[model samples]
Target: MVDSAIITDNSEVLLHFDLKLEDGSAADSTRVHNKPAKLVMGDGSLTPNFESCLRGLKAGDKKTFTLPPDDAFGMPNPDNIHHMERSKFNLDAPAEVGMIIGFTQPGGMEIPGIIRAVAGDSVTVDFNHPLAGETVVFSVEILKVK
Candidate 1:
């Protein structure tokens, strides 16, 4: 039996997690050597289905589940790729392949874009998350329930 109220909307939880891809490739894992991640439920930071899986789980509970791309980061959008003049970037920054750069948005929010390619004067950046279209497997161990 577990305390249902231990896991509720807005509750804070500490969990050690491992995120894997469909090919059994390890994408990210806190279990390797990192502190547990702290997240507040229903904060829009987590997908509804992910949060649903945590519901009714208490401290010391462990679970593993897979989330489809749509439920995780959602599929990548073609529109997220944009080509801009190399001059638009700071020369000191030095555009390189696979480098993530932060671009300021109209709303003052910084969006991270990965450098996909660079030509003589044009640079292609992709705003989609690296894991956007990948189905992810999450293995979670609840450390604390608050």
Candidate 2:
């Protein structure tokens, strides 16, 4: 019932987060950008599970927790993997494995796709999120909960 000191629906929160993989390798961190994230609690930007973790947290609280693939970014879908002809790519810099490229959708919105493989004249592009299927640990330093 104490709304001022704790996170609640519609509360404006400012926090820094560190996202890491199961192997303890760094995935991403707000500290690296030096700009803490600002968002309203219960916003659609956060996954339901992630928001649940922040529900009771207050300013100056720091916590780290792990999320399964489903609750995190989610599992990869086979339908997200597309095969295209090598000719579809620019000849100057052809598609190569591990390359991330922006693919324009029918609505003109661009999404990132990773080049997974190249065999003969075929190119495989994975449209799944880069962190899909990952069990990640998210550490949050709550700066301002209201």
Highest lDDT, which number? 2
Worst 10 residues of 2 by lDDT: 1-10
lDDT of 2 at 87: 92
Model 1, position 86: C-alpha lDDT score: 91
Query: Best candidate per TM-score, number?
Result: 2
Residue runs of model 1 more than 4 Å from their true location after superposition: 1-5
Worst 10 residues of 1 by lDDT: 1-10
lDDT of 1 by residue, 1-146 (tens): 55444788899998998889988999988777877889999988678988998888889899999899988888999999999999898868888989999999999999999999999999999999889998999889998888
Q: Candidate 2, which segments miss by more than 4 Å at Cα?
A: 1-4
Q: How many clashes show up per model?
A: 0, 0
Model 1 residue 10 lDDT score: 91
Residue pairs in collision within model 1: none
lDDT of 1 at 141: 91
lDDT of 1 at 4: 40
